[model samples]
Target: MNRSAAPLVRELQPGEIGPAAAGLVLDALAARRDPVIGVATGSSPSPLYAALSASGADFSRAAWFALDEYVGLPAGHPQSYAEVLRREIIEPLGLDPQAVHLPDPHREDLQKACDEYERSIAAAGGIDLQILGIGRNGHLAFNEPGGALDSRTRVEILTEDTRRANQRFFDSLDSVPTRCLTQGLGTILDAGQLLLIARGQDKAEALRAALRGPVSPECPASVLQLHGRLTVLADPAAASLL
Candidate 1:
């Protein structure tokens, strides 16, 4: 990573990260009439969602967009991002389900679906703030290692590490979808601000590599260095190497 352009990193207790992140979102919403936000799923953001939900923040006018979706999961599958966001973020925050959007990985024409997703983001005035979680392998969204840094919304093969990491959500490793539709680095960078959350010692090395190592596709999260407004909030374990 380029140290000069690295994100402003903050080390906070696990319980504090959620309120801090929710504050950012609430502030953004207050500053704009209808701010658009991009959201990510996984363990890292659970606390943040909880805080937002409990804060009584108004999200009625916010437009929500998801980072990615598994390619083959059923529409209402309990593990699908849609279902996950509904339970974790949307319903809790009292967001209008009609205002939330996600990529359609199950569509027959996935490429077109990706294109439409991109267009929808642009039409909504782009994302004001994008919440993210870095994978252990340093992947951003589902743009795995070696993916183009300037890629757009598209289909990608999930890495073995990604599959294994997500296995906790499924009955078996084989149950995880091998492919996904994800917003590319270019799409994520388009946001006015980026907020990334990570916790646990398992993410320590990846967080270090992303913030202090050379910027490279091999560690996709490293691209955040090029983003002008990026904030990384992590607990001690995840911030250890930084």
Candidate 2:
């Protein structure tokens, strides 16, 4: 994907991104039965999920996959991606809990678990649409800067920047896990479409780098430039730099 030619950007008002994103997924569902969707955690996509739930969209037939999960956190932890999705997405949207999937950060054989996850995505016919949020450092999922762009689903050490950014979710900075299991860039690129959402001025610089900067590993999200179809929805503050 050419950096200049890929990723169609849309700058919308504060409350517009959520409904816009929901409409895109609903449209996809209309075109295909049981569409597989990739979900993300964080403030950026929270409104999107809420809008989806409020729209009375039928998610009973859809398959859900999370972008990543923190390692070492016990099951049912409030901060765990699985539990977060369950509370914020699945239950609200009335999605079949059985069809929702997330990486097992606690699996003994983590490599095997990652392999199985990749296989499961393939078995589900790949993700029809993927929702994503860019870290302050421009990481996608847990594919931190300086990591291989072609990486697959696997464990990764959280960068200091990432850990600090996520500290708000924990009791303290030290309480934040140093590692996580994330779908790699290669995995994310497999999605039929990528929908990246952002809000607030804090995200402006990162958003600018991700959407207008060079396609280098230092800015992992820049790899989205290689995607066949990409859509970015951002509030005025987040799109300010652009």
Candidate 3:
């Protein structure tokens, strides 16, 4: 497969990015009878999710899968990725809650949980499209720097940078979970298409590293360069370096 092409990068006005992303989702939804959509949770994707919900689009036939989950949070914790996506995308869009899947971090056999998540993705016919966000440190999902490029669904130790970035969602930095179950870079690349959203000046350097820097484990998002179909939406601030 030809995976060396650079992603299509569109720098939109801050307010225009969300609606354009929603339009892409609508196109994907119409093309597939039962689309499996992989979604990321973070500030970058919040606007797209909000736009999708507000557009009154029908997501009932779509199966939503979270890219990762915190390892120790309770089932209903407000900060849990499952709950975050539920509140941000599922409930607002009136999706069937049962159709939304999250990696089960509560399982004692965490590896088994990861394996099951992979199997579940396979059974759902793989992800038709994946929505993604890059961390300030260049991590994708929870797959931190130095993870294997061909890694599978598995648990990963959170880097201090990641924890510090996520601290805003928790009561304090100490409350942030230090580990998570995340889909590997390989798993993310398996999706038929990828849509990466980035905003703000804080993401500029990471976005530069991801879209233009070398493809290596040091910048997990750089793996996007190896995917056949990738689209990136960014504000001028985020795409400044590019």
Candidate 4:
């Protein structure tokens, strides 16, 4: 593990990922009141969601926000971040959906909506823990590498690698929108703590570079290495080079 250059690089044994994330959540809850947390979408967090569901913790006081959303996808879409979260965490936990907020996918005034989203986040108090899933291209959230780190909540053109990775979620690549709205690195970093979760060989190289490589927009997650409390959790294959 490249401990010297990155945050803590934790190689967790199989079947341990969910508990780890839940533990982190509990830790955060113990650390502060009504903690603000950032969530990520997709399969990587399924275990985390399950673990959380089993925790029996009271989160009525917690505030939730997510990392990104696909532009043009209806909020009602099964694949939409909002619905995915509602299925995985909200309804099951009986969380107050009104307290949980995510970027709206169907907004006609996208940038303004993002601006308001950012404002709401800031007003609710900055995020306490921001969970993330990296892109095959080293992008964090949807802030594709090579994009400005100082960016805020805004629209982004989905990169080819990102589109390919998400193709399975859609009927076909042609159906995927070319644009998305994601919380930028700067916006994400505002969170007091961050957790980047990676698993499987598909993310091995990207994981290695994020921990050992240079800090650059060329590898957006690399910037997390600069944060005081960023944590990278992965299985052995994802931790191949450290």
- Residue pairs whose backbone atoms clash in candidate 2: none
TM-score of each: 0.97, 0.97, 0.98, 0.95
lDDT of 2 by residue, 99-209 (tens): 999988888998888888999999999999999999989999889998888889999999999999999999999999998889999999989999999889988988899
Query: Sort by TM-score, best first: what order?
Result: 3, 1, 2, 4
The digit string of per-residue lDDT tens for model 3 on 52-111 reads 989988888999899999999988999998888878987899988899998899999999
RMSD values for the candidates in order, in angstroms, are 1.4, 1.2, 1.1, 2.4
- The per-residue C-alpha lDDT of model 3 at residue 129 equals 93
Positional deviation of residue 49's Cα in model 3 after best superposition, in angstroms: 1.1
On residues 192-238, what C-alpha lDDT tens digit does candidate 1 reach at each position?
99999999999999999888888899999988988989999999999
Determine which window of 10 residues in candidate 3 has minimal summed lDDT: 1-10
For model 4 the local lDDT of residue 117 reads 92
Model 1 alpha-carbon drift over 4 Å, by segment? 1-4
Give the whole-model CA lDDT for all candidates, comma-separated.
0.92, 0.89, 0.92, 0.84
How many clashing residue pairs appear in each of the predictions shown?
Answer: 2, 0, 0, 0
